[model samples]
Target: MKLLLVDDEPVALRFLSGVLAGRARTETAPDGASAVAAFARALDQGEPFDAVILDIMMPGMDGIEAARRIRALERGRGREGACRLLMLSCLDDAEHQIISQYDAGADGYLTKPVDSADLLAALANLDLPENPLDGAE
Candidate 1:
C-alpha cells in the first residue's frame, strides 16, 4: 500500500517505518505542515496515499487540523474519503479525543507506544488488502 507516516519524533518515525518494512511503500513527514504539503503533492501527481498515519500532537497545525484539511483537499479533488487516516497520540488522555478525531476524518485512533500487532490489526480492520498479519496464527 502507499502510506504516509507523520510524526515529529524521529524515533517514533523510525519505529513505525521499521514495523511496516516491506509491507508498504511509505513516505514520512516530520510535522503536520509538511505532511499536508506532501499529501497535496501526491494527489497532484496522481499517486495519492492509500492511508495516512498521523501523530496528533505536533509543533504546528496538529494532526487533527491536518486531517481536516486533507479531507477538504480530497473533496476539492472530487475524491472524498479516498484515503484512510489513522491518528496516534502520546497522550494517555487521548481516548477523550477519539470522538474529535473521528469528527475530523480519522478512520482509526491508536495511543502512543503503539504495538506492531495493534497497528496491523487496525489496518486490517480498514480492509487493506492482504494484511500481513491476517493469517499469522
Candidate 2:
C-alpha cells in the first residue's frame, strides 16, 4: 500500500518506519504544511497514497486543518472526497477530537505509541486483500 506517515518528531517517524518495515511504499513528512503540499503534489502527479497516517498536533497547520484543506483540493480535482486519513497521535484524549476530525474529514483514527499488530490490522482491513481498487475504491 502507498502510505504517507506524517509526524514532527524524527524518532516517531523512525519508529513508524521500523514498525511498517515490510510496507515498502511508505513516505514521511515532518510537519503538516509540508504534508499538505506533498499530498497535493501526489494528486497532481496522478499517484496519491492509499492512506495518510497523520499526527494530530504539529507546529503549524495541525493535521485537522491539513486534512480539511486536502479535502477541498480533492473536491477541486473531481475526486469523490478526501483520502483516508488515519490519526497516529499520542494523545490519550483522542475521543475528544473525533467529532472535529470527522467534521474536518478524517476516515479513521489510531492512537500512539502504535502497536504494530493493530496498525497492520487496521491497514489490512482498509486495504482489502480481495480488492485491487483500494486507492480509488
Candidate 3:
C-alpha cells in the first residue's frame, strides 16, 4: 500500500514512519498544505495513496479542512474507491470531534501516542488490501 503521513512534529512523524515502514510505502508532509499538495500530485501521477494518516492539530489548514478538500478533489475527479483517511490527534476522543472528523470524510480516528497494534487495527478497519509484510521479521 502507498500511504501519506502528515504531522507537524518531527519525532511523531519519524516514529509513525518507522512503525509503518515495512508494511507500506510511505510519503510524508510536515503540515496540512503540503499534505494537500502531495495528495494532488499523487493523483496527477496516477499513483494515488491508498490511505492518508492525517494529524489534526497542525498549523494553518488543519486535518479537518484538508480532509474536506481531499474529498472534494476526489469528487471533482469522479474518483471512486478513493483513498481512506485516518485522523491522528492528541486531543480527547470527544463526541463532537469524532463527529466532525467523520463529517469531514475521515474513515477512522486514533488518539496520539499511538502504538503499532492500534495503528494496524485502525488500518484493518478500512477497506484495504492485505499487507504483504504482515508476518515478516
Which of the numbered candidates is closest to the native, going by highest lDDT? 1
lDDT of 3: 0.84
Clash list (residue pairs), candidate 2: none
- State the lDDT of candidate 2 residue by residue for 1-52, as single tens digits: 5778899999989987887776547789999899899999999899887777
**Model 2 segments more than 4 A misplaced:** 128-137
Instruction: Please state the error at residue 49 of candidate 2 in Å.
Output: 1.1
Q: Write the per-residue lDDT of candidate 1 for residues 15-121, one digit (tens) a residue.
A: 99998898889999999899999999999999999889999899988898889999999999999998989889877675536654666889888888899888888
Residue-level lDDT of model 3, residues 33-134, one tens digit each, is 999999999999999889899998899998888888888888888884488899998887577366646678888888888987888878867877655534
Local error of candidate 1 at 7, Å?
Answer: 0.2
Report model 3's TM-score to 2 decimal places: 0.90
Please give the ranking of all candidate structures by lDDT, highest first, separated by commas. 1, 3, 2
Comparing 2 and 3 on TM-score, the stronger one: 3
Count of clashes, each model? 0, 0, 0
